[model samples]
Target: MYDHRKLGRELNLFDTDPLIGAGLPYWLPDGALIRHILEEYIRSVERQAGYRHVYSPVLGKRELYEISGHWSHYSDDMFPPMDLGNEQVVLRPSLCPHHAVMYRSRSHSYRELPLRMAELGGMYRSELSGVLGGLTRVRAIHLNDAHIFCTLDQVADEAQAALEMIRRAYEALGITPTRYRLSLPGPGGKYVADAEKWQRSTALLTDVLERFGLAFEAAEGEAAFYGPKIDVQVTDGAGRESTLSTIQVDFHQPEQFDLHYIGADGAKHRPVMVHRSIIGSVERAVAHLIEQHGGAFPAWLAPTQLAILPISDAELPNAAALARRCAELGLRAEIISAERGSLGARIREVRQVPYQAVIGAKEAADHYVSLRLRDGRRLDPQPDGDVLARIRAFVDAHGTALWDNAARHCPERKS
Candidate 1:
């Protein structure tokens, strides 16, 4: 089992310090780049699916959670409200109420049945210190979260659409959920006591899952206080199950917040809200990816796609120039300056770098670069333009690894 925490330290990805308080892990440049890529990728998918992203403040007034009922049921899991002279506020533990406010910002007609709003936003939760071990469990979390407000009749279809988006992301990342859980409110529990609404929401989620042909187990007392949810469980390399994605159907929130849309009959009707998170937390997902590939990321997601190594000081200019050109072409490239260690030793230091380009006196004069993939496969000197093109093509394809023949084939040798 590859421990992500250990790998995180080794790769200089992220670290926690008491100066900033526990559970608040700060990202290093390399890890920050990886997170930026994840966010951009998910954002592109959301845009294509008609989900408009929004930004909201981390602090919300005390009344916000009270209106959403989080204050009644989950206040212990949230930060203590701060007294600000005139108003009390706390870091938002979830975006639900704020999103509800957005929906209430204007009146809508049934024709605008489904309104999908998304955010890659931060939230703070108060978790016990014992559970705050790594990126997976922390006080600060960010999610690829969204909320869709639609008519009652559109409930099943909208939830299904959200699931499809989740599937697209899971497929692209090569992460598969091993188990599906349909979490429902248990009898006489912390959940809202709306029997009719619970049954209706649970039924809607179940029907959507059935339509999507997903097998799931029903877990009692596993639901959010306001609604039932579909939780996705992925078993990690260590054989431990972790929940990284979820789709929740909430009928209670709209009612509590007095959210309504005008119906076709000109009467007001409450819209069903479907809440979802594709990658539960950007930080945790990066940690998962670190373990998945053992720190050697695929070309598309690797921070430094190609590292340039010069044989000596004489070739530094050529190496730097090649890196600069690659960067201009939108490929992440970095130059490893001439150093005291053997070229091999220096390359080993950044072994996780997807590709390394070595420029020697001859190669520099000829405007060529010798490519060495992370898997140790070496290729003959090729024109600088050819190398960059190959890299760009691989990234365009979202290559799962550096190359199909990164470890075996010599491009110069025929099959």
Candidate 2:
């Protein structure tokens, strides 16, 4: 089994300390780089998809979740409230309520229907020690969460689009869903009391799934507290199945928050809330990614995209120059000097790097670099401009191949 906990430690990606508590791990330098790249990629995708990003505080007033119904149904999973003078605040377990409040802050017109708001925000969960492990089950989570406020009529299309976005993101991230699940509230579960709202939300999700021709199972009791959702499930190396992405059509929150938009008919109408997460939580996503690739991430997501190796002291200057050029071209390049070890040893050490640019005495004299790919393929020495251009192209395209000839087209790149 490819366990992220083991691989993460081996690669110096992330770690947990007793003082910081279990369930809360801090990303090492390399891990933080990967996370930053993933975040920027998600933000770019969301921006192109018409989502306006926002930053919301991690703590919310206790009354906020109470109004959103999390206090009534999900308080067990939430941290205890902090008494701040007369007001009490709690670390939010979810981002929807904060987003709902943001929506209600101002009135909206029909033209602004389907206002998509996104945030890569932090939230906390109070998990029992036994249930917490690595990044999968954590106390602090930075979720890739978003909410779309659309009219009731636009619910199906908005949901379908969100599912398509998730598919594209998964393809780019190299994630394969074990199955799609239509998660419904199980009997006796802590769900909203409105049966009609539940039925309506479930039907909308079902219609979207059917229209997309995706085979899914209706699983009772797997839903969010307020609504049913289409869950994209993935299995870890330990054979534990969990949802990595979701799209939920929620009519409950808008009503609870008294959210409204003026319709063309000059009447204030309630807008439905469409909650979507392309990547549910950054920690878990990166954990799965670490295991999926066994820490050899794709070029775009790799902590160090290119490793410039100098065969001897004579080639160190050339290696440094090449590294600087790579940096200017937006590649994360590290120069592994000959002082570290022999060329073979350094090559073995940086095997996870996507591209290895070797600067030997002969190549340095010729102003060329011999390319060694992570897959162990070597190419003839190429000029500096040619090497950097090819590497930049691959990284920019976010493709899965070391070279264009073997590249798999990423759907997200097309968008």
Which candidate number maximizes lDDT? 2
- Model 2: CA > 4 A from native: 406-415
Model 1 spans with C-alpha error above 4 angstroms: 404-415
lDDT of 1 at 360: 90
Encode model 1's per-residue lDDT on 168-193: one tens digit a residue.
77767767778889998887758898
- Clash pairs for candidate 1: none
Instruction: Quote each prediction's TM-score.
Output: 0.93, 0.96
lDDT of 2 at 212: 99
Q: What C-alpha lDDT do the candidate models reach, one value each?
A: 0.87, 0.91
- Model 2, C-alpha of 204: deviation from truth (Å): 0.6
The stretch of ten residues in a row with the least summed lDDT in candidate 1 is: 406-415
